[model samples]
Target: MSIWWSLHLRREAASVPLARRLLLGTMETAGVDPDVSYDLSVALGEACANAVEHGGGASRGGSSEAYRVTAYLDGEKCRIEVADSGPGFARAHAPRPPRVDAEHGRGLFLIRELADHVHIGDKPGRGGTVVSFDKMLKWTKDPSLLTA
Candidate 1:
């Protein structure tokens, strides 16, 4: 059996901390590796930031939007999905190759680089995008559970 949790977060930068807390708490209880948790946190943070930035319409005064985040964890992997309300990203827009001096776009880029698998889904119902990514985890066993 796999463990899965989903959260609906407002489309605001302030929600980043909330998202982090949820991710940390979920992964920690699952016995995920420390390094993997850190990486996934960073990746999930970036994905959330992008959702807020783009969902807010940046300078277009669109503040009625929201986003959703879902995380699934199994014995060997942790997968997360970030969704937004409107102005979602296109599915085919692959993350650009890293550059030494570029400074404009790179949120999804980092998510792709760090996650073992990444999936971008079209907005459901209305308009928005859901970017999903997963990271592999090292397997560990607890003797207590076997004896329980």
Candidate 2:
């Protein structure tokens, strides 16, 4: 069996934890390995935090003050995507690594570290940022859902 969910969340600091908790709970209920669940949850939190902090622009004129998070658990892999209505990345420039002492720019880097695959790019047609990642899941000895 496969499980998936999507949330349209307000871009508030409080919303970050809500999304994290939901992901954690879903992974737990599905009997995903605790360590794997934790790593993905942390990555999810970072993406959500970025959305809250940089996912909007007043100059965009009535851009929605919300973002979207979508998660899919299929077979032995899980994928998560977070998208926001902010100024999209420049077509000519890719994300660069932050300096060692930099506090801010580490979220995307950290997400890449935790997940098996990561994609960061502009939303198609609409102007926004999208960060999506996938991880190979490890299941507990006893799982609530049957493995494929």
Each prediction's RMSD over C-alphas, in Å, is 3.9, 2.6
Each candidate structure's TM-score, on Cα atoms with residue i matched to residue i, is: 0.80, 0.90
The 10-residue segment of model 2 with minimum total lDDT is 55-64
Candidate 1, which segments miss by more than 4 Å at Cα?
Answer: 57-64, 91-95, 139-148
lDDT of 2 at 94: 63
Can you give the lDDT of residue 71 in candidate 2? 98
Give the residue spans of candidate 2 off by over 4 A.
58-63, 144-148
Q: Report the Cα lDDT for residue 42, model 1.
A: 91
**Model 2 collision count:** 0
On the 0 to 100 scale, the lDDT of residue 59 in model 2 is 31
Q: For residues 1-148, could you state the per-residue lDDT of candidate 2 as single tens digits?
A: 5999999999999999999999998998899999999999999999999999989855354555989999999989999999998888676866689999998989989999999999999887667899999999998987665553
lDDT scores for all predictions? 0.76, 0.91
Per-residue alpha-carbon lDDT of candidate 1 for residues 34-68, written as tens digits (9 for 90 to 100): 67888899999998998888765432334336677
Q: Alpha-carbon error at 10 in model 1, in Å?
A: 1.4
